[model samples]
Target: MLLLLLGYDAINWFDGRFSLPTPGMLAAPCEFIDVVVTERAAVTGDQSAVAITFAAPDGSPLPAWSAGAHIDVTLPSGTVRQYSLCGDPTDQSSYRIAVRLIQDGRGGSAEVHSALTVGTEFQVARPRNAFPLAVGGYNQTTSAVRLIAGGIGVTPILPMLDMLDRTATPWSMIYCGRTRDSLAFLSELARFGDRVTIHEDATYGPASAEELLGDLTVSSAVYTCGPPPMIDALRAALVDRPDVEFHYERFSLAPVVDGREFDLRFASSGEVVRVAADQTALSAILGARPDATYSCQQGFCRSCAVRVLDGAPEHRSTALSPGELDAGYFLPCVSRSEGCLTIDM
Candidate 1:
């Protein structure tokens, strides 16, 4: 059966054939693919939108993806950033990503916003997902779904709302931005009637995290995506409620200089790196061995993740939930060694 499957995949690749994965194959993992940006446009004041078109080597559709899956785009400056697919997953023609230029960022968004143009080629890892929509339970019977987005965090939620509308699922969205003019998809979100709420910090007082989520019940599931300050605030405000499923995405890395010095021991390589108060474990590793691989040094990508064999990791990545952190996985890119730590590397 394994030989048959391998032969079939080979034939499909060469013949330009594509289909959904079988149940057995689905249980196995999928490989990443390369995609190219065929078109680009400036969508908002500081956001530029790009449409990436991918195909099999023989011009067939690539594997289908789910709604929340995101692809990592290797920018012109070699910085890899993950952007959620805003296009319909059912559509195989192309995938679209909207990037907001960050004035003070480490240059990934700026390079994408300024340099990338039509016909630019870049490699994309296959869609990997950490935030998938809840299917049954409260997600199914709930009369309404509330989506909270902060700034550029709206990209992933856009397609989710479309999918809900297509299924005639009742949902509402609250988009928070610094100002009315800075919000992306403002006009489109407004068309959803009172179901869509826009909060501008410049005009209305900043959206109160406690006030906004205070009334959440077991019947409702809340999805949030934004920077650390907002997510941290919301998490703290809603810490008492374990009944409500809170899903969120963060784009920022953990602070490296906040914690005290800690020792890190790599089991596989028998290497010990002391994480200084001013340096992260990843930085220490890369400083000693410059060939270490990493992307999105923000901890959003799992590229720099190492298995924690023992001791606690001061996990600071928004990529992993509390459950995953408890399971002993650590993203060394942004996470610091809380104390003496041993990792499988």
Candidate 2:
């Protein structure tokens, strides 16, 4: 027994404890609190133009965050919505979020317009960022940065503009809206003079993608946030220039009319499900098992990520990096399997 243990057992014991390093622990989700609205203000003449403030207990500042971070607000109706942090990051007395009522929205904004009042208490999520400013070496060069905003998509760009202003970095902004009366932050944008350009669709046709985005150089970066049509147009216009960094955020999901049906197999659970053309990969998974947990099903959130064991996945989500995708990880929310896929579950 001692001789046998000295051979294979010794190698196995050493490999178990000392051969490989322990994997790093996963990051824990941030916590948020329910705060009462202290003040409300209407910046624009429109009644929908509203500003709400939330304060932490003892009147101390909330957690420090970088520019371009957005806080998730749970309205009185229990609807979760994300609003960009419009207040200065350095000033932490309270968090500020500006909201405009979307008449066509599916009850979220409508609830805020009718139900939210001063002194109302609602749950709020800590600031999370999808859009972070490129700094250091990325900012040292005098590369042209263009920001295109449609309607409320201008929220995130506000803080970005503040950063650019402080750094004295040259940047340009093109804001498009149906009319001046409907647009928010008009006064603030007007102060930027020629650096900011406004295009009202009522007077002139919406800005053309090709015309607005002329020839692109390798040093240019274009950030766009808007409706599907605006994003599609920008993507089409810049499809030829792959070198230029194009960052965009869509407020709503794009309509998916054409997708092939596929099969998804979970290796760990030994479960398999067929996904239809009309059903998203996430929808199929959650339908098969109601216990599935996910946040931000639009692919912006990395909550529903799983490891791909076999087959290639058509990467559609924005959460994972290119290297991560190459390593067989995918977000089932907006992504689908190109063929039959086996996931670790």
Candidate 3:
């Protein structure tokens, strides 16, 4: 199966063929309800686990989500961040997610840690799932499922593990992090007994991807999410196991490339902004239009994607595929222009 990004949506491109959502299918209404943070605690030494409750101001049930689903949170500072739902999918009263503070990050995690508290009111985009679990393992030929997660990537996997356990599916997990103290959901995962393996970098150093995945047979299916390096290593190790279906989700941004200064012409605003070699097009665009809609400034989310009207674009983000570029879309958060460019804004 091939995955392609066209604008902000992910299209399942299989065997050089795919179907686009029709106008009616793409026009579902969404509600951004004001949710109150009901509980907040440190799940790990460094990660803060938060639970937010949502209900209609007039008392009605909020939207529901599946395992591996995430919601876009608008922070107190107006910075948008996406967090995977780690709590019970059956609980319609609340949603839980873990946030790890990134000291060098663009202030989203920091704002989440400092500003969010019990009783604090916040707004979030309804849950959306880009990484969904294949119910009962999509590979009918396989009965074994392998789940792998690294660092904070374990958030989404928690729900999958829960569903699998309840269904009595044959599955196992490999969880890795810098240290035991940095890992979350330890006590819960412990219930799975020997089926789960934890690897700490400080104690065990790095776990061999090949060794961890070597036992998987052609009739096995694997799902994993983590930093790009770990994902790349796992993919390389399992390259020979094409018969075993692989599902992955990556939230980290691609490395930024050195870019030259370029002129950004906004067709809608009739404004011209200069993007410097050391700066991002987002910074320039947001500086001029503070009301600009954007999220996940690291280029993980396609919230800042725009249509290119002219000139060549130096696409630095992993958000868009080759097909998306050919369709004239570019992510301004991390991507820059090869030369002068005009944007639809």
Candidate 4:
């Protein structure tokens, strides 16, 4: 993604997308709510994915959400995990999200797959739409919106497809995965017919990110969710395609690049936490302060922003406003300091 710079004082858009917020953006709260698992099903034949539905115990309307919203689910083991709401946004009776068992990931997914069941009660933060779909005005340069998904990334795009269809908007999607068995919701995509394209790496090589770079192809507005390599390739290919309005949500936190070890000192407690080169300041501080609040491990959500007492922090998250940065705020999730940072905690 391209990074943009304003004047010397303003801290340019830090998402690296370097773009303005599109239509239908809404501020979301991080408040938690009580809910129970009303239904569960395996979307993938290989048992890799489990589609779970949650609703209020009394069946009251849940919080309203947009197409690309996600909720932070607190599992039985007290592990918090974020999952995109794939079900209809218009439905207030319940919210649906899917989880693909990630053996190599943190233990959250494993506990979800093993312990989450019908009638399971848990707390989930109200839906937060970090990837809101562009609704009202379509980009004039591009005629339609292109939806792209990779592997389990389809979770967010599913509600997008429904929203486009309901509004009678022109759009298409390309779903890529390692194989057919690994891709979730094939039967769901079948409803869209030829508008949806499936590329499995088992047969054809991985989908090329360059395919959408052509002027005649890929709508002017493109939204994609996928693993990093695919997302990175698309961003690199679109670097020169300035006419295209591109937005993406990554499946995981970005690895700290050119990272160096730093010490984080707490101003209130007078304690210190050593952040390794590969570790985020948020992760390192969480070990010492388990009560610290955070939602998206990615930097875009400002749930992890802290006030910097001292030191030069390399701000990497877009969530903090230029004014916030000027006020000595820092996002430890993605930002790193040159040497040591004293924070308010």
Q: Top model by TM-score, which number?
A: 4
Query: What digit string (tens of lDDT, one per residue) describes model 3 on residues 1-345?
Result: 222121221111000111222221111133567777777878785554333344444445568899888877766665556777888898777778777777676676777778888777787779888778775745445567888888778888889987887664588899988889888888888998989998898987878887456487556777777776776677777666656667776657444457678999988777999998878887788788666655556554555667788889877766576776787878787888778888886
- By the lDDT metric, which is better: model 1 or model 3? 3
TM-score to true structure, per model: 0.72, 0.74, 0.75, 0.82
Cα lDDT listed for each candidate = 0.63, 0.66, 0.69, 0.75
Candidate 2, residues 112-192, lDDT tens digits: the string is 656667777887778877666663355255367788887767766777787777775567888888887766677878878
Worst 10-residue lDDT window, candidate 2: 6-15
Q: Which of the two candidates, 2 or 3, achieves a greater TM-score against the reference?
A: 3
Could you tell me the lDDT of residue 105 within candidate 3? 67
For residues 1-345, write the lDDT of model 1, one tens digit per residue: 000000000000010111232221111122556666666766555454333344433445756777666766666565556677767788876777777766666666767767666666666567766666654435365544668887777877777877777764467778888887678776667677887788888988878886455466455567777776777787776666655556776655434557789988777677888988877787876666555555556555555656688888887776665765666777776788658888765
- In candidate 3, stretches whose alpha carbon ends up further than 4 angstroms from where it belongs are 1-30, 45-59, 137-139, 256-292, 297-302, 311-340
Tell me the deviation in Å of residue 210 in model 4: 3.0
Candidate 3, TM-score vs. the true structure?
0.75
In model 2, residue pairs whose N, Cα or C atoms come closer than 3 Å (at least 3 residues apart or on different chains), thus clashing, are none
Clashes of 3: 0
Which candidate number has the best lDDT?
A: 4
Candidate 2 residue 276 Cα shift, in angstroms, is 3.1
- Better by lDDT, candidate 4 or 1: 4
Error of 1 at 324 (Å): 17
Error of 3 at 243 (Å): 0.9
Off by over 4 Å in 4: 1-29, 138-142, 211-219, 257-261, 266-279, 284-293, 300-303, 318-329
